[model samples]
Target: MSTVGAQSRGVLRAACRQVGLPDEGAQPIRIAGNAIWRLPGGIVARIGRPDGREIAERELAVARWLTDSGVRTVRPAIADGPVLVDGRPVTFWDELAPHRPGTAADVARLLKQMHQLTPPASLTLPPLEPLTKPTRRIAEAGLLTTDDRRWLQDHVGQLAADFAGLPAGLPAGLPLCALHGDAWDGNVAVDADGTAYLLDLENTCYGPPEWDLVSTAVKHLTTATVTAAAYEDFCSTYGMDVTSWPGYPVLAGIRELRMVTFALQIADEHPHARAEAQHRVDCLRGRKGPRPWTWTAVP
Candidate 1:
C-alpha cells in the first residue's frame, strides 16, 4: 500500500472506533484526496486530510440542506459529527444500493433542480473560488520542472482574469444559486430503479449556474469523455448548451486546468498518476495542439 493509503486506513480505523462501527471488512471505495471506505451496515465513511475538518463539516451541512429541500442526495448517516480522528476529519454517509454512474441527462436534471432552490437563510455557503485548488496544486506539484510550473501558474493567472471579467456573466436567464460545484455524470449515481442522487457535497456552493454547466460542456467539447449524443441529451434536458455561450472557453479552460492540477497533486503520493499528469500538462503547453485533446480520466 502507498503511504497515503496506509495513513488513511489508520485514520479510518480510529474514526470507526469512535463511531462504534467495526473496522473489519471495511472496503476501500477510493483513496485519493479523500479516503473513502464502505463500512458495515450500509454506511460509507469518508476520511479527509488533517486540515479538512471545516470542509467535512460543510459537506455534512450541505447534505442536510439538500435533503431538506427534497433533492435526492446521499444523506448524512450521523447528523452531528464530522468526527475528528487522529486529526483527519471523517464523515459518514448512507451508502446507495446497487447504483451505476448517472447518465448525462440525469446529471442535467439534478443540477437544474439544485440550481433553482434558494438555500435556507441559515446555510451560509461560500461563493465559488474556481482557481483556489488548482493554483495551490500547481504551486505545490513537485513533479513539474521549474519552467512547467511557471507556465502553468501564468496560464492560471490569465484564466482567473478572464473568468472574473466575463462580458456576459451567468448566461441569459439564470440566476446564481447553490451549484453542485463539481457537476458531471460521474459525480451522480443512479440506483436500480433509475433514480439519480448527487454525491460529494464538499464543493457545493453559491455560484453561477454556468459554472455547474461547464463541466458537461468540457466533457463533450474538450476531453470527449462523454458521447456527443449524451452531451446533446444533457443540454436538451437542462434547457441550455453551455458551449454555445460566449464565456464558455474561459470556464472550460479553467475546468481543464483543474483536472491537470488535480492529477499533479496526487502524482507524488500515487506514482501511477504521474504519466497521465504529465500528458495533461503537455496538452496544455500546446504540444498536443488544441481542443478535443485525448485526456484520460484519472481517479
Candidate 2:
C-alpha cells in the first residue's frame, strides 16, 4: 500500500472502532481526495481530510435530501452523520450492489433530474464557488515552483473575474437549481437492472445547471476521456450542449485549471505523479499546442 493508503487505513480502523463497525475485512476502493473503504456488512466508509467535518455532514444531508426528493441515489448507512477520528471525518454508506460505471446517458439523465428539483428552504445549499478547491490546492501544492504558482494564481484570478461577469445568470439563460457538483459518468453507478444511482455527494450544491454539464464537455473536448459520440448522447439526454454556450470557454478554462491544480496536489504526496503533474502544468502554460492534450489519471 502507498503511504496515503496506509495512513488512511489506520484512520479507518480507528474510525470503525469508534463507530462500532468491524474493520478486519475493510477493502480500499479509492485513496484520492478521500479514502473510500468497503467495510464488511455491505457498508462503505469514506474518510475525508482532517478538516472535512462540514463536507461530510453536508454529504450525508444531501443523500437524505435526494432520497426524500424521489431521486435514486446512494443512501447513507444506519449510523450517525460523521464521527471524527484523529481529526478526519468518517461517514458510512450502504454499498451498491453489482454495479458498473454509469454511461454518459446515465449521467445526463440523472443530472437533468437533479437540476430540476428545488432544494428545501431548510437545506441551504451553498452557492457554487469554483475557486475554493483549486486556489487552495495551488497554495498547498509544494511541488510547484514560484513562477508556476504565480502564473496559476493569475490565471485563476482572471477566470474568476470572467465567471462573475457573465452576461446572464451562469451560461446566459438558465434557471439555477441544486447541482450534482461533480456530475460525470464516474460519479454515477449503474446497477444490474440499469438503474442509475448518484454517488460522491461531496460537491453537491446550489448552482447553474451548466456547471454540471461542463464536466462531460471537458471530458469530450479537452481531455478526450469521453468519445464524441458519447458526448453527443450526453448533450441530447440533458437537452443542452453546454459547449455551445457563450460562457463555456470560461467555465471550461476553470475546470481545466482545477484539474491541473489537482494533479499538482497529488504529485506533492506521490513521487510517481510528479512528471505527469509537471506535464499538465506545461500544457496549461501553453508549452503544449492546444486543447485535446492527453492527460493520464493520477492515483
Candidate 3:
C-alpha cells in the first residue's frame, strides 16, 4: 500500500473503534476526496478530511431529508450523527448490495424527481457556489507550478465575473429547488433489482436545475466522455436540453474549470490525473481544442 493508503487505513480502523464498529474484514472501496470502506455487517464507512466536518454534517442531514421525502438515495446507518475520529469526520451508511452501474438516463430521471420537489422549510441548503471547491483545489495542488496556479487563479476570477451575469440569461419555468449538486452517471448506482439510487449527497444544495444538467451536457459536448446518443437520452428523459439555453456557455465553462481543478488536486498521486490535468489546463488556455481532450478518472 502507498503511504497515504496505509495512513487512511489506520484512520479508518480508529474511526471504526470510536463508533463501536469492528474494523476486521473492512475493505477499501474508494479513495479520492474521501476514503470509503465497506465494513462488516452491511455498513459502509466514509472518512473525510479534518476540514470536511461541515460537509459530513450536511450529507447526513441531506440523507435524512431525502429518505423522509421518499427520494431514492443511500441511507445513513446511524441516526445520531456523524462521528469525529482522529479529527476526521466519519459517516456510516447501509452498504448497498452488489449492483450494476447506472446509465445517464437513470441520472436524468432521478435528477428530474429531485428537481420537482421543494425542500422542507427546515432544510437550509446553501446556494450553488461553483468556484469555491475548484479555487481551493487550485490553491492546494502541491504539484502545480507557481505560474500554473496563478493562471488558474486568474481564470477563476474571470469565470466568477461571467457567472454573476448568467442568471439574467437563464431560462425560466423550472422553479429553483434542491439540486443534486454533483449529478452525473458516476454518482448514480443501481441496486440488484435495477432500481437506481443517488449516492454522494455531500454536494446536495438549493440551486438552479441547470447546475445539475450542465454536468452531463458538458461531458458530452465539451469532454466527449459521454456519447452524443447518451446525452440526447439524458435530455429526453429529463425533458430539458440545457445546452440549448443561452446561459449554457457560462455554466459549461465553470464545469470545465471544476473538472480541471478536480483532477489537478490529485495529480501528485496518480500519473493519469497529472497528465489529464495538464491537458485540461492547456485546453482551457486555448492551446488545444476541447473536443479531443479526455480526462481520466483516477484509479
Candidate 4:
C-alpha cells in the first residue's frame, strides 16, 4: 500500500477499535476526501479529516433525517459516530452488499422524490454553495500554472456572481427544495431486490431541483460518459429537460469547472489523471473545443 493508504488503514483500524467493533479483515472501499472501509460484520466506516467534524455531523444528521423521511438511503450503523477518534471524525454505516450501481433513470427517480419533500425544520441545512469545492481544489492544486490558477480563480468569481443572480432568470414555477448536491448515477446503489438507494449525503443542501438534474444532462450533452438513451430515460423519468432550462448554462459551467478542478487537485497523487486534467483546463480556457474531451476520476 502507498503511504497515505497505509495511514488511512491505520486510522480505520483504530476507529473500529474505538467503536468496539472488530477491526480485522477490513477492506478499503474508497480513498477520496474521506477514507472508507468496509469493516467486518456488514459495517462500513467513513473516516473524515480532522477538521471535517462539522461535515461529518451534518452528514449523520442528514442520514437520520432521510431514514425517518422514508427515503431509500444508506442507513447508519449501530454506533455513536461521527465519533471523534484521533481528532478525526469516524462515522459508521450499514454495508449494502449484493448490490449493483443504479442506472441514470434510477437517479432521476430518487432525486424527483427528494425534490418533492420539504426538508425537516430542525435540520438547519445550508444553502448550496457551488463554488466552494472547486475553489478549494484549485487553490490546493500543485500542477497548475500561475496563469491557469488565476484563470480558475476568475472563473470561480464569475460563477459566484452568476449563481447569485440565478433566481431572477430561473424558469417560472421551478420548485426549490433540498438537493442531493452531487446526485449522479454513480452515487445511486441498487440492492438485490432492485431497490435503488441514495448514497453520499454529505453534500445535501437546499437548491433548485435543476442542480441535481444537470449531471446526467451534462454527461450526455458535453461528455460521452453517459449514453444518449440513458440520458433520454433520465429526462423522461424526471419529467424535465435541464439542458433546455434558462439557467442551464450557468449550472453546467459551474459543474464543468468543478469537474476540472477536482481532476487537477489529485493529479500529483494520481499521475494518470494529469493529462485528462490538463485537457479539461485547455477546453475550459477555449484553447480546444469542449466536445470529445474525456474526463475520468482518479484511479
TM-score for candidate 2 = 0.97
Residue-level lDDT of model 1, residues 1-299, one tens digit each, is 77888888888888888878888988889998888999989999999877888889889988998888889999999888699987789999999999999999999999988998998888889998999999899888989999999999999989989988974565668877898899988899999999999998889888788999999888888888889999999999999998888888899899999989999988977888899999999998999888788977666
Where model 4 places Cα greater than 4 Å from the true spot, the runs are none
Candidate 1 colliding pairs? none
* Stretch of 10 with least lDDT, candidate 3: 290-299
In angstroms, how far off is 168's CA in candidate 4? 1.1
The whole-model C-alpha lDDT of candidate 2 against the native structure comes to 0.89
Candidate 3 clashing pairs, residues 3+ apart or interchain: none
1 against 4, candidate with superior lDDT? 1
Assess candidate 1 and give its lDDT.
0.89
- Give me candidate 4's TM-score against the actual structure: 0.95
Q: What are the per-model C-alpha RMSD values against the true structure?
A: 1.1, 1.3, 1.5, 1.5
Give the alpha carbon lDDT tens digit for every residue of 34-126 in model 2.
899999899999999888898889899989988998889989895477999888999999999989999999999999888888888878788
> Per-residue lDDT for 95 in model 2?
93
Query: Clash number for every model?
Result: 0, 0, 0, 0
Reference-based lDDT, residue 16, model 2: 86
Q: Which stretches of candidate 2 lie over 4 Å from their true place?
A: 167-173
Per-prediction TM-score, please? 0.97, 0.97, 0.95, 0.95
All candidates in order of TM-score, best leading: 1, 2, 3, 4
Q: Write down the lDDT that model 4 would get.
A: 0.85
